[model samples]
Target: MTGWLGNRVITQIGILVHDIEQVSGAYAEFFGVDKPPIAETDSPDMAKTRYRGQETAARAKLAFFDMGPLQLELIQPDSEPSTWREYLDRHGEGPHHIAFVIEGMEEKVMLLEGRGFPLQQRGEYEGGRYAYMDTLKDLKVIIELLENDKR
Candidate 1:
């Protein structure tokens, strides 16, 4: 917990998959839970997605499973350039990132960047924003920061 990012808890673990429907079904069977619904990422107007510092129309199909303390996320990226697509292309279907629900996203991003993990992708969702940090070299996995807007 006393690390660079300062947070100790991971709220979600993301996995990259080529076939979201198949994987979601498999997950549901394996976990003995109902198959979660598949959904797509927001449009560029709403997501405001950016990858490697440039704006992009990155979109992905997503399914979420609520575990006890951590959620499992399945991501199937479109052809557009994005952290999810890039990782899927390079590494194949597997673990992508561990996410931390946080406050002061910009500050945490700066802190991680200062420690040499550059920001790779960022986007906005319905109620919050997310940033993917390129921490693979150092930590062997990307780090995702999620900040939900306060009501």
Candidate 2:
């Protein structure tokens, strides 16, 4: 898999949280680690899709921290009825998915889909693409493919 995706590998573990500040603080306090920097993003397509048949905006707050070789991403969505919000509503707050940094992401996603792994979500961010695969059948977990980029 790493060969097919170049040299990229599992570089991050993402956990969705309902309250960014509270969850981030709890992790910091429990692990005695410094808080990471937070980044905010808005996508017009996401907003339109989320508010389909209505009018609204898609806004999210994200924070990333380096934990040794892996990064931890905390996400909080301000938009209503979004993927993040929906996940939180269904599952509460905890480890949501594990992200694998990969190259040729589109090809990989296509291959996976052909092999019966349909994508749960896909979007572009910071010059890279991300696709989530529903791995519930095999691992009871979700897998995320992330293209390498500064974001």
Candidate 3:
């Protein structure tokens, strides 16, 4: 709790899926909750999308469900060249990453890189920044860091 991750809480679990509508409903039924809200990434969301540090136009459709302390995220990758797309292409639909709500995201990313996990993808949204780390090989799952806007 006192390391690079600090006291930040893990606020999300991202699942990569092929179809948002289908999976969202299924997940809702399984969880015994109403269907979650779905949102599509705009062009601006992918304006700075990067895979292995190179920018690309990777897009995604996302659904969110409030599950007690954390939000469950379902991601359906578009045709753009992105980490989600790569994940889907390489491994098909499944649990892709677990995300931590962090602060000083860049610094944490550097610390993780120093520990041998490189940044795999990054994007900035209205009130936060998110980056995915290449920890799949070592940890069996990717790690996503989210730094919400302080304001």
Query: Best candidate per lDDT, number?
Result: 1
Per-model clash counts, in order, read: 0, 0, 0
lDDT, candidate 1, at 76: 96
Residue 75 CA displacement from its true place in model 1, Å: 0.2
Better of 2 and 3 by TM-score: 3
Ranking by lDDT: 1, 3, 2
Ranking by TM-score, best first? 1, 3, 2
- The residue-by-residue lDDT of candidate 2 on 44-129, one tens digit each, is 56423323233435567888878899988898877465556667788888777888877787788778778776777666675676
TM-score of each: 0.97, 0.78, 0.93
Which of 1 and 2 is the better model by lDDT?
A: 1
Tens digit of per-residue lDDT, candidate 3, span 12-59? 899999989999999999999999888977675444677887878877
Error of 2 at 88 (Å): 1.3
TM-score of candidate 3 on Cα atoms, chains taken together: 0.93
For candidate 1, give the lDDT of residue 125: 98
